[model samples]
Each structure stands twice: as C-alpha cells, then as structure tokens.
Target: MRLIEGTYGIAVLHADFPDRIVVARNGSPVVLGIGEKEMFVASDIAALVAHTRQIVTLDDGEMATLKADDFRTYTTEGTRTTAEPTTVEWEAASYDMGGHDTYMHKEIHEQAEAVDRVLRGRIDDRFSTVHLGGLNLDAREARRIRRVKILGCGTSYHAGMIGAQMIEELARIPADAEPASEFRYRNAVVDPDTLYIAVSQSGETYDVLAAVQELKRKGARVLGVVNVVGSAIAREADGGIYVHAGPEVCVVSTKCFTNTTVAFALLALHLGRTRDLSVRDGRRIIEGLRRLPGQIAEIMEQEEEIKKLALEYAEARSMLFIGRVRGYPVAREASLKLKEVSYIHAEAYPASELKHGPLALIEPALPTVAIVPDDDLLEKNRAAMEEIKARSGRIVAVAHREQEKADHTVVVPKNEDELDPILLGIPLQLLAYHTALALGRDIDKPRNLAKSVTVE
Candidate 1:
C-alpha cells in the first residue's frame, strides 16, 4: 500500500499492487485483483466474468482499503467513496444474430454495406477528379510519389499486399507491403517524397507505430488507413482514411479487412486519377466499387452451405490455402483466420509454387482452400486444383463461378477480377468462423491474444 499526496494536498491512498491496477494518465482506476481463484473483480466485468460470475467494479476515486472475505472501499483523499453492486445484465444475444446466426455471419453480411460506406461521398461520378480531405498532397505532390510502402500486421498486412498490386497496376506506382515488425528492424531507405501508408484496425499496433515514427524521422510522409477514430496511428499520421467499420469485438477480423482493402482501393484509385490515370480506367474502377456491396450481400446468403462445409471439414488435421496475384493475400488471411480461431494447422501457398513443394502434403484427408477468382490466373489455378485432386486432396475452392475442379465450391459473387478479393475474402472468413464455432473455440477473445497489441 502507498499514499501519494498531490499538488493540492490531495492525499491518495492506493492499496492494490501495481500490476492489478490499470492506471491511466487521467487518473482513472481499474482494479484487477483476485481474492481467490474462484473470486475476481475488475473495472470491466467482462474481463473477469469468465473466471467468476460474481464481479464488481470499483468506483472512481475509490481506494480498495480492505482485502479479505468481505469488500471495503474508501475515497482517495480522506473522504469515503460509496460502494454498490452494479447489476450488469449482459445478453449474449447482443453479439449474436444481428442479422445472422453468429457474429462472424453477421459481420460477413455487413461487408457489402461497409464497403459502400467506405466509398460513399468520396468519389465523383465523372471519375476525372479525386478528393481526399486529409491527403494534403495536391496533384503535383501526389504525382511525384513514385514509390509506396505499406506497413501492417496480420490481416491488415495481407490487405496491404493486395493494395500493393492495385497501386502498382492502377496507379502505376511501385509499391511493396512490408510487415511492420520486419520493416522496423531493417535498414530501410525512406525520404520526404516517399508515401508511407500504415494499415491497422486498432490504429495502435506497436510495430506499425514504431515503423511510422521511424519513417517520419527520415522525413517520409506518413498516411494511416485505420478503423478506430482516435487511435494512436490515426492521430500520428500526416493523413488518414478511416475504415468506419465500427467496434469489431471479435478478435478474428472479418469486416475490418474488407473495409481496409476497399478504403485502400479508393485511395489508390484517387492517387491514380490524380497522377493522370486514364479516365476510362478510373470510371471502370469506380463503377466496380459502387457495385461491390450488392455483390457481397449476394454471397452472404450462402451461409448454410458454408456452415455445412465447415462441419464436414471439422475433423481435418491440416489445411492448405493457395492463391496467386491478389489472391495470395486473401489466401494468407484465410489461413491465418483458420489457424487463429479453429486451431487448425493451415498454411497458404502461391498456386504455382505448390509444384516445387507443399504438393507432397496433399492427400484425400487434407483440405486445400484455393482462392480462385475468375482472373487471368484462373486457368493456372484450375491446373493446380487438378494436381491437388489427383493427389486425392479435398478441395474447398473459393471462386466467383463454380468450377467443377474442386470437391466443394464456395461461390463468391461475380466481380471484376481486380475487385474479386473483396468478395472472395468473405466466404473464407465465414468458413474459418464456422469451423471455429464447430470446434467450440472462443470466437471473440482468442486464447493469449489481445484485441489491440498496444505495448511492444
């Protein structure tokens, strides 16, 4: 226990151990301590309720003066703070069935609307001009950016990978997606003219923050594409685009990934237009963006089929995901979601590279998820699917149109090949979610993982 006296002779008595108290700069106190293994208390009941149904939140300015069989509390400065039992009636239904059976299902259904919201009011119908309020760069500055560096972690990093392909192809700028952790540790070349875009859902990923700060130190212009309104990254970046996906309570991200990718597409297209991109091409992309939401909703209605597939594959010991070009990133994210939520051993590979290796792991019992959007590489991917099939591999193909090459087809709604990742991504996310549910794993708070990795 310690007593601290402040500037106004405001004496504060703190009794809990340092680790048990979640202290903020604003002097908010969050008590996280255990009376017994079966008894726990915290500022937020959700953190402890899983361990013990009985819980309490310490009031502001209160000092937990007594620690025994019963609870006692007092004010920080010689006054008494009242203690009360707050009746928090938490309904699981709040997170369940917003419009679907599971949170993941609801989240998948929300993607189309989410994409529309991200694109709303940001594009001009003519597609000849672009306006990004936070991007202080004018046409000249935007045109001068010859290279782009995207930094993020997990699903966001995969989105960055897709962004790189889009930016390079549409905007005609060379782009590379680097994992923030690896980017920070390496000796990277950055300059004032370089446009560094940091992608994160929480806006407070430690490695991303550190990498952006390092880039700024080298005088590179930093832009952040994040979901949270007032996150550390959002506040720190020179320019930022909000995903506006709302509070994603689930640890395995679904809506946020689609939102981020769509937002990046808008940004890339905007930059492309500003840099003298062909007017026809720009209009085509804008039209595709406008149509993405409806396509997403169409795909969401296939939940029952996806769930059934999940149940059928629930016993699979190992899974492989394959994709090429933009699909590679989707494959990576799909593999990550499966591993994180379902505890399934899943790995992603570029379809072409499977011939060199990974093909050896293919068997009738193993499941292979191929992200085969109807793109230029569709034929090659089909060829790869043939190899998996020859090896007796169970194929769960995520494609726009059903190809008879796979054992089970998860049909993604039709979209421009460049935009297929946004639609194709949903089914895989749902597959992982349903599989996790079948395995009876925690859907929101996965084991040993925090919603935001705020600390290094």
Candidate 2:
C-alpha cells in the first residue's frame, strides 16, 4: 500500500511495478493518458499529445490508482469516485521546439503568432464587442461590476498590473492588481460586485490557485485568464478566457506574457463596450489589437541590433529598468527576464520612484533601460532618462520614437497609448534573450529555477 500525504499535486508511474501507478492533485494539474500497455502522467497535456489525446484530468483532493487496463479512484474523504477521460484537440507540433536553439528563443519569436491566436475569433466588429466565452458575465452583469481586482504571481502578476491598467482605462472600472501570494494571506474582503481575475500561464500556480480557492470559498466569483486548458484554476474558477499562447517550455515566460497582455486588451475591450464606451473608440482599440501581430513581427526584426547591444552590455555587473504607468509593468517584466536568464542583478522601479530613493544607485558602471511611451507621460519619461544621464549611466530606451535623451534607442512600432505596453515589451524580450545568449547562460533552463512553480 502506498501512503499519500497532503495536497502536493503529484503523479507517479512505477516502472518497477509498471502496471501500478498513483496520481493525486490539489490546486495543480495532472492528466492521465491510457495507452495500449503503457500509461503516462504529466502536468501539461502538451507532454502527452504525442502518445494519446485521450486523457483524464484529476481534480483537487482526488486520487487514482491504475493497474494496466484497470483503474480505481477515491476522493480525499475515502469515498469511491469516477472521472471521465476527454479527448483534446491540441496538435503535437505545439510542443515541438522547431529549429530554434532553445525553447526560450522559439517562444520569444512565437509572440506574433501567439498574439494573433488570442485575438483571432474573439472580436465582434459588427456590435463593437468581444466574446470571451469564459468571462461568464453578460452585458447587464458586466455593466454592473463596480470594481475589478486582478491577482497573479511573478510574470502573471506583472501581466495583471498591465491588465488592471487596461481595464481601468478602457472600461472605466476601478481596477487594481495584487500579488496572489499576498492577496491570499491578507484576509481580503470579498465583494460580490467586484470582478476577480486570476492570471497564470499554467493555471496551476500555487499562490494563484490558493487565492482562487479562497475567493470561491468566500462566495466571490473568480475568472481565470490562463494559457493551459483544463488546469486546476481553469476548471475550478467560475469561468475564464484561455490565453491560447501554446506551450511555454522555458523557465522564464516570454510568449505567455505578451499573449496575456493581449488577452487583457481583449477583456478590456469587452468590458468597455458593455458600458458607455463609444463605438468609434472601441473600433480604434479593436483595430489596434488586430495590428499587434504585425507590429510584433516588425519589432522583432531588430533582433540583430538588440543582439549587438546585448553584447556591448554583456560585461555589465548590474542593470536598472524604469517606466511610468503602462510602461512600468513592461519594465518589471523585462528586468525579470534579464535576471532570470542572464543571472544579472537587476531592479525595476517606476520612473516616479527613482528620485524618491533609487536615484542614489545610479552610476556610470550600471546600465538603465527606460520605457518612453509617446503618450502624455513622454516628457516625464524623458526627464527620467535625463536623470539617469546626469549620473553618467548608460541608457537603453525602448520607445515609439528615437529618444534623444537616451544613449541608445530601440524604437518600437507605436500603438494607442493604452496598447503601447503590448508593443513596447517585445524589444525588451529580445534584449533579455540576446543578453543571456551573449553571456553563454543556459537560456532554456535557467539555473535554480523550474518552468513551473508548483509548490509555495
């Protein structure tokens, strides 16, 4: 008899006892694949698409034991139960690394296609609305939502910051983002009139899952903006929209971040139209969303230049990233990518926060990357660039136009002010990729990090 303790979503396939296997899940995902004489278990369906499309998704507090062709399941309460295996339509090619050197590079280049995938069939041009099947909110209900709270961890939390900005901008909803880890432990007041969004690429992030469970337990509705289908958060949340960014194998998230931001734009557009947003503005946002794939492709063409820049800065000991408003989250995520893969000590601060305390750290040896959006805050961002320049700091600016104040400028294609983050972030992803490549770091599997953080 095998003893299974607490809720650590685990799947075991005993090669010694080939036929005997045990699977248990809670707040994480486990899929079981039944083959002719073999069996498989994985955290993601992408891993099992090669062998079998038919799979069983184990729910929270559920356990199953398999012996070749026979299987039995039991609830955490010791009651006998049954789970149905469903057929997935995902193609095997989705998981392949293709010809890229690493999964990170492949995923970075896939951003264009990934963004297009998220926007493909969701927009309704005729009615100036969006159809997010998993939102589970109607026109009347969406209009009634007074406030929106987005929760996530790491990269997802950064995306949530961007999402909250978009929601507040377009939908005019009082929106904000919080780290799921903190949100769950704070004894948050669950309001029925507020929309709660849990953003995660795997949908199995422990903190995010725990937050979702807590919200659900408190009788508050939750929506999941997740990439992986049939993940714990996806299945447990009242409803949600799939990011459809495909499988991200790299430890540092790339495509999922961009695609999730695009997904947020779609969500924002949907919410905006439900309220008093004019048709003209909604159409403009829709058109901007449609143009992202091409814009991303255009920005990626500068990879050679970015690589050269990375090589130039490869010897740098540390880095600083700063931006204002929408660009703030981009700075945070870009800094994360750089540190995660390149192992460089990096910090991201809001441009407004620099003078308050971070200004003391600026120096000639350290490089600064500033996001200068061609919006109302353009002058403020330029002023921040000047501040870094005053400290003799080398500045690399990602902006819609060449920044005269920056030492070097990487110009990205301009989009609407609200949509600028989606476009402005692409070059930084390339910057991180090329920087790590120049430093000869393990690009796909970063040291001391896993692709998914299943444990708290």
For each predicted model, how many residue pairs clash, with residues at least 3 apart or on different chains?
0, 0
Q: What is the C-alpha lDDT of each candidate?
A: 0.76, 0.88
- Assess every candidate by TM-score: 0.80, 0.96
Point to the candidate with the largest TM-score.
Answer: 2
Q: Give the number of the best model, judged by lDDT.
A: 2
Question: Looking at candidate 2, what is the lDDT of residue 402?
Answer: 89
Q: What C-alpha lDDT, on a 0 to 100 scale, does residue 318 get in candidate 1?
A: 89
lDDT tens digits by residue: candidate 1, 1-456: 144432111223366542232222112224333445333444333454344434444433445543335555565555655555443333334344575555666676778777877787788877654467876777888888979999999888999998888888888899989899899998887766678999998776777877988888888899999886545577679987988775566778899999998888888888888886899988888888888888888777888999999999988998999999888999999999999889999999999999898898888888899988887888999999999989888898998778798988988777666677878878888888889899998877788787666545
